[model samples]
Target: MGRQRTVNDHGFWHSPLLQQCTTEDKTALLYLLTSPVSNVIGAYPLVPRIAAAEVGWSKDQWLQVIERLRAEDLVWFDPERMFVWVRIWWFHNLASQTMGPKLRTRTLENIRRLPEPWLAPFLADYKARLNEEQRELLNTLLAGEFSENDASVPHGYRIDASSNFSLYNNNANAKPNSNVTPTLEAQAQVPVDKSGIPPESHAQVEAAIANAQRKGIVKADTQAIIAAVAKQYQAGRPPRDAGAYTYSIAQNLASVATEPSPPAPPSESELTAWADLCFCWPTDNPSSFIRVDKAGFCEQVTIENGNARHGYMPLGPSKLLVALREGRLRKISAADFEDLAKGSRP
Candidate 1:
């Protein structure tokens, strides 16, 4: 597919808001605006790891940039749902135009798919930007338009001076308004104590949750997975790497949810032979499979003269047995299996 194009307002550089952003923040914002995952409506799903990879930065670097942008009110990121809303996207792209029926339908679908907390805020912004024709179209398409008086607007919702919508009550001392609606950004900013998570570990858990979603764990299963992690923390038995532990649990849950019946236990005979395993190169872009022939190895491959050779440094037979049971190895018939033991380029 060809690269997608997004509008870049010539006035962007002159904006006062742009002056406040660091070079890194500006780069991150521009990337989000033009990212392939981004759509016409500007709100879209974006995995933190993927975004990091796109910019040739570490995950931490990407998270830091995103957090800064969020603080500056340039974007809203929902770590749990992996969604992003570029705050002023409409101004540069759709504000001056009247959308056709097809575009309007697609836009509505995109809006509906936004994370629950982002829906109202995005709609509010979208409604405010509509041209007369667009507004008329929206009136027909939506049962109730975005409005302060609209029932869909939460009870305490209000638009502040900056035009940001918040759901805090007037009673400042009344237990901090537990009834306030949770937006994705608000949820991300929830206090560590209330969330049962350590202040420093939010990013890790978010990354883990994104990983889980990629591994086929559905949104419905997230609450249960989070509960399991929270229970461990409460019991004072938290894992050394909370993110890794959460990912492992997610993997287990995903496996159970997908596989109706477990495979037969590995036999002793099956455990001894070399298992030929084929995996794709550059995982995300798989043009060819890089086959590993010596499938009995239990440790990292040894490199000699720029070639990979296995079995020189074995962890143990016990680990090998575990790998076999985990379905990580499968025996395959190849005429030159031994010749390819050292993972030669295909």
Candidate 2:
């Protein structure tokens, strides 16, 4: 029996490559994807007549669509064996990939239904086009016969049901908050270091520090180092010696923190004062950015000595500060500051 299929609405509609296809082409493609015969692998038994009937297209129209898809390398067709292989099929259907040895068993069942050689081209195409991880999964799915040396066949490698990380991080390949089950081959890729120790708990960290103090590590700064080391060990970078190694790590943090802090943002009142001193805001035109002296005065400055005058557009205190910082407004000249001081009387 063919495996179940799932089509994501967002992924199907907004796919970059599908955006290139016409509306009619998208509809036809969707039908091919969701049809009964199209299994989890996105390849299935399909002849021209069968496709034409299922898609409600004339044989000629169907051939034209197929030709377009083939040109884009979207779908590959095998005329001799009547097979259809959708390119990059694994990427789309990753949500259904929890199958393990059962997958290999299913392939053996399929071999009897569709002669084994019919699968050769699909498997070869998958290997050449896919990455190592994806290629490994494709091979696993097609491995129908039992192998004494199969890595998954080993009883020890079976997914540990009680492991929280494996359960919560099931879809390691997909985005966060997704339930997509990644292939077993993908899970095998995670770097495992048997020698790496688990992080210390908060109580354990405190206990280690108390122990360090008994060993004459009672300096206040030394205690700070122990705290930082405890944090690192707790965060999965466990050290071989949790009790004594924290001081060196803490000293490193002190050196790292010596970099200068970033400048603070100006207060809202400062922005308001700067605007009141600089611009005659909320202008008559409601559009002109009216430049003003410190005492609420406006200016008509000509551009390039032309009769055409430069006008100030209205900007709130926040936006006016942005203009000043961004250099859209120039700094006041010394002579202009003298004039502004004279006009300061209101």
Candidate 3:
């Protein structure tokens, strides 16, 4: 089956914008709405010729329609970048004022894939359109400033495209130019006196960040770290120890950016204990089990009739051990073996 995309039939035909469009303009709008190159975010890569040809319109005819649409604030196109931003696409499709973290993550992922030119404009549009509550929700989800007009933008970063940092462009690859500039982490090194923190505790805050950096646990900037700590103080839940609190907050922020490392392989006896606890004993008639192989790795295996059918990457026994200790691993069943064999989550 072909991939399917959602089109708000009611919203599209009923929109006041459609009333302003000519028949040709409506056709062009429909093409943009259902275009194969378009994505859920409505911002996507496309050359002018491809769009023009898709609708069986001459290049000039398509450009004329596009110009009319742009004049009415219906769509935005960047000729040099070959990208289009279909205005109000989100309003028509996503519809909801509030976005959950998963949807927000998906939206940001699509936005980041656009040519760099689209980043500021896309954010600016959202900032202008969303209400205070919606903006705060997005900001919290982004975990950084989104305003292009903000002073922080001049410090030489865009959104963190690669996930090392959030809205303040912590991704090392987000450098907009070849000229050398301070990175987000470097900017954080400069102390933030405006964080509403007591001057006396400032040194402690810096020390905590430094300590975390020394331990290779901190991946965020100093300002972000201070902001996190300051939030706690404002909430009337000040930590008993300033340094420890700062370190913990920094660790939490770093945890969001850092990918977790695999646990070390456990002893053979430990794996067996985990397997027994989880009821994954070697029954040899379609079941999922955990076992320690000769390579000293604990692998999750699916077997049927005394033959191994599927296997997952061997993991350290730590997670299984904890699950076993807490009686959390559910009893294995035929359904689990099917899920394991199909590479589906159980």
Candidate 4:
């Protein structure tokens, strides 16, 4: 008599398959498969804090299991790099083998039914790379399952590769109505201006400063201190050297608020602005008044005889700029203009 294969009707992994793994390994694997686990295909690094919370284990226990898994080629940890990598291929293979072909087929069919447009490209690419057996399995699974609802072509079927398909369907039936406007009661409560500064204005300034810090225009410590002071002042507790503090914080906050938020890595808009600024202004002995180009590039020019001169200074490559535009640069490090300048090219 052969051992019967276990299958999970839920389509993910099942308890029966988990029985093959040690208790600790099972716990770790289950945590990795749970929601909030990003980067499913490759190595999944788990932070100690997150692992502790997820598995109700101490840091040492979690580390022990992580080490054991790594030794078994189930996981990998790079302490120096601060990442815990899981071998997804091995885990999936173990599950598939235990669960049998039917479970794998059903799981894949469900994945194909996911309506997100962003996932379409990945699915198409994966389908193209599939072996004949895999393709046949997928087709067979899909054949007897529920048929997909036929969606009508939108009025404007401009194939937007960048547009979010999931968002499209969500907003499809939405319509504007006169009664849809928010009532006065629904509006946010404006705090009274007790500090002689309008509460709204103070909030705006604080928000701007936060935004600047987020965009790498300011440091986290600087932002934290400024925010603390602003909050205090807004609540009627002015700091020492109130005027200077207000001015400094306001200036920093305003700088970011004035600029548009950059999108994605290597933002074309910011780069173009930098390029234009480089070509339009003088960079030699640059002054605070020197206007930056749309892409945030400074131009080169000499001010001879106390008059403004302008010429393009060839721009430099900057990883900071890329990080800033990509929204990955941390707020704490971003406030130091010198740090950002280090990555900027002439």
All models: lDDT?
A: 0.55, 0.46, 0.58, 0.40
Q: Give the TM-score of candidate 1.
A: 0.43
TM-score of every candidate relative to the true structure: 0.43, 0.35, 0.38, 0.23
Model 4 CA deviation exceeding 4 Å by range: 1-20, 89-346
Ordering by TM-score = 1, 3, 2, 4
Worst 10 residues of 2 by lDDT: 158-167
In model 2, the Cα lDDT at residue 282 comes to 37
Query: Whole-model lDDT, candidate 1?
Result: 0.55
lDDT of 4: 0.40
Minimal lDDT window, size 10, model 4: 157-166
Deviation in Å, model 1, residue 75 alpha carbon:
0.5
Clashes of each: 0, 4, 2, 18
Best by TM-score: 1
Off by over 4 Å in 3: 95-98, 114-118, 127-134, 141-346
Whole-model lDDT, candidate 3? 0.58
Stretches of candidate 1 exceeding 4 Å from the true structure: 96-98, 144-346
Model 3 — which ten-residue stretch has the worst lDDT? 158-167
lDDT of candidate 4 over 189-225, digit per residue (tens): 4322224443323322333333333234343333333
**Local accuracy of candidate 2 as per-residue lDDT tens digits, 202-268:** 2223323333333333344433454566566558777544433543343244423354443344455
Q: Is candidate 1 or candidate 4 better by lDDT?
A: 1
Give the alpha carbon lDDT tens digit for every residue of 77-139 in model 1: 777677888764753575434356556667777766877656665555555555556666676
Output the TM-score of candidate 3: 0.38
> What TM-score number comes out for model 4?
0.23
